[model samples]
Target: MALIHCPSCAKRISDKAPFCPHCQFARTDDPESLERAARIRQIKHNQSLMTHSFIALFAFVGGFALWWWGGEAADGWRAPAGIGLMSAGFVGYLITRVRIVLAKRSKG
Candidate 1:
């Protein structure tokens, strides 16, 4: 039998199989069920992306607060450390947002 991708888990499986071995999703001729599974998966992925973005935003804010602490010129290590954290958080947040948009636009 030819190998096909499972609708639920996207794993390679035999086309003749009735269920996915990986995720145990039953394969059927019904388009509605397949579409439902795909939709659920997409929703879950979007939620995860949102969580990542939130964490990144929190980090960015925290870094800014740390850098701005006391208002006076940041002395030795704190300035550099805060700047580094801010850069990392900004990049992470941007990438996550891009991924979220792409995921939403994708059909499957």
Candidate 2:
């Protein structure tokens, strides 16, 4: 049998499979169902991206606050720790934003 993609989860499966092993979706000839499943998966992925971006923003802001709270001095642990957090958060936020844009662009 040839390999086919599961309509529900988009995983590879045997064409002769009676049901999708990954998602337990029964084999069907309905195009609408496949479209609906794809939309749902995309929505979930977008939500996850948003959540990650929010967390990154929170980290960045918290780092900035910590840096200022420590009197903006370079001779303390707070300075280095805050800088590290800020860098990580900034990078993470940028990556997430790019992924969001790409995901939106890929909508079919």
Candidate 3:
């Protein structure tokens, strides 16, 4: 219910607005909430990446270990499976990157 200055454009506007009505700046008040939301989204996105990357890393490790230990499985098979894990990790990374870009655009 009080007036606030917009961080982006330095205009006076209502504090309740998530973005400044005048110049579309972020409201100074409750910036922590916004930051927190951003962080939460980032963590979730990164966690997803971690999951995918871990799967890939583990697959690679398992394949390497088996090969190193002289396992009977074909080298080509293990290589392809490792490649699959890396592809999954790459997909996850791309997803998170898109999400971050979208979020930044939305804030504008």
lDDT of 1 by residue, 6-42 (tens): 8887889999998998999999979999998888777
Q: What Cα-based lDDT does every candidate model obtain?
A: 0.87, 0.86, 0.60
- Candidate 2 Cα lDDT to native: 0.86
Q: Residue 108: error of model 1 in Å?
A: 11
Ranking by lDDT: 1, 2, 3
**Model 3 lDDT per residue over 1-108, tens place:** 998655554457786777767655454447785576556655666576567656655655655554445655446665566556556655655665676567557657
Model 3 ranges off by over 4 Å: 1-29, 66-108
Per-prediction TM-score, please?
0.80, 0.81, 0.37
Clash pairs for candidate 1: none
Write down the worst ten-residue block by lDDT for model 3. 65-74
Instruction: Give the lowest summed-lDDT range of ten residues in model 2.
Output: 66-75
lDDT of 2 by residue, 1-108 (tens): 999888777889999999998888888788987788778778888999999999999999877887788465545788888898888899999999999999989984
Look at candidate 2 and tell me the lDDT of residue 44. 82
